[model samples]
Target: MEEAADGDWVVRPITGAATGKTYRCPGCDQEIRPGTPHVVAWPAYVRDSDLDPWDVDSAADRRRHWHTACWRSRDRRR
Candidate 1:
């Protein structure tokens, strides 16, 4: 897992070979096709956070897939 520069998220790279389903990128609102390399990111779970960071269901529900470039430039987009 990689931390976002802003410390707001935890990101994980997904290999092309591992991506079997399509996903819509929240950044660009475009389709991430199957077999495409991408990233999966979820909110950073701080200790004793109000969102119940330890809850696996909460974290899984918040996970989003993003294109590598879109994720890299996320802060710059409107």
Candidate 2:
């Protein structure tokens, strides 16, 4: 987990699980293939001077799975 410009990013790499369920990448609106290696990212707990921690955490809960490329390109879009 690390502090990110947008939010605290907690990123994890997943592999070798044949979970048949598919996840949609919010970055690209495409289905993440079953058992495919990818990134699962979320916001880390943050202590802000001017913001509520719970609000930041709740928004982090909305974190979505993303293709490696898509996630890496996140900053470029902005």
Candidate 3:
């Protein structure tokens, strides 16, 4: 797992061999075909500030799959 440059997210690489299903990339609105390498990212949770016990679950629910290139250049895109 890798921390995003902005420190707001945790990103993990998905190997082509491990990808079993297609996913829609939020960055480009394109499909991430099965067997295509990609990244899965989720929002970083801050346990100290939040009181909600479901924050962890919420973060998991927000996880997204992104094309590696799209994820890399996400901040630069408008």
Candidate 4:
């Protein structure tokens, strides 16, 4: 893991919506805690619609990181 800068680690939302570092999760309809595990649903990147780690036009670019259970659920849905 890269060293977190002084202003780097924040409890902001992952999506680009909301001002500053706050965002609402589309999956759980709740706020995202930086230190906790939260579920997020993101659209595929425009370039490769099947790829993960997509760039968003929000406050921050949203990327995909699948937990073990989340990964399994994703596979089953495919």
Candidate 5:
């Protein structure tokens, strides 16, 4: 893991949820190139539940960004 300026160890995305899309850096408002090294906040891992179960096919773990410029490069479909 590479050490970020904010003292976070940035690691490569190991899951398919972050595979193809472009993400923006919350710190710099620059494009986070696909497959590039980035500092991602890993979410809490919860067991599958009936009320709020995880969808294996859905990109559920995709985290939100701190800035709009950090959004995916593709225009979102409503």
Candidate 6:
């Protein structure tokens, strides 16, 4: 867990098998195929004050998938 200017982030390194879902990598704007290891992350804050636990589903929507290389150097893609 770490806090930055953007927001609090819970960084998790995970194996692709665990995901059981395909996602698009925001860092590279490419498909993150299932069974391919990647990163899954979520913000550590609550967006709505009245919401419970900050709305995990909403956070998941906001969370981004990233290729390992893209995460290491996203600026290169830009």
The numbered model that scores best in TM-score is 3
Q: Which stretches of candidate 3 lie over 4 Å from their true place?
A: 1-7, 46-56
CA lDDT, candidate 1, residue 78: 66
Q: Global lDDT of each model? A: 0.82, 0.74, 0.82, 0.36, 0.42, 0.72
> Can you give the lDDT of residue 1 in candidate 6?
79
lDDT for model 3 comes to 0.82
TM per prediction: 0.75, 0.70, 0.76, 0.25, 0.32, 0.63
Model 6 bad stretches (over 4 Å):
48-61, 74-78
lDDT, candidate 6, 1-78, per-residue tens = 757555676767879768778889888788988898987777776567426645455555566778877765655666
Per model, state how many residue pairs clash: 0, 0, 0, 3, 0, 0
- Expressed as tens digits, the lDDT of each residue in 1-78 for candidate 1 is 556655667788999999889999999999999999999998776434535645554555578999999998998996
The order of the candidates by TM-score, greatest first, is 3, 1, 2, 6, 5, 4
Question: Comparing 2 and 3 by lDDT, which wins?
Answer: 3
RMSD of each: 3.6, 3.8, 3.6, 11.0, 10.3, 4.5
Report model 5's TM-score to 2 decimal places: 0.32
Give the CA lDDT, 0 to 100, for residue 26 in model 2: 79
lDDT of 2 by residue, 1-78 (tens): 856678778887777384467999878889998988788887675446325535553536656788888888887866
Output the better candidate (3/6) by lDDT: 3
On lDDT, the stronger of 3 and 5 is: 3
Backbone clashes, candidate 2: 0
Candidate 6: which pairs clash? none
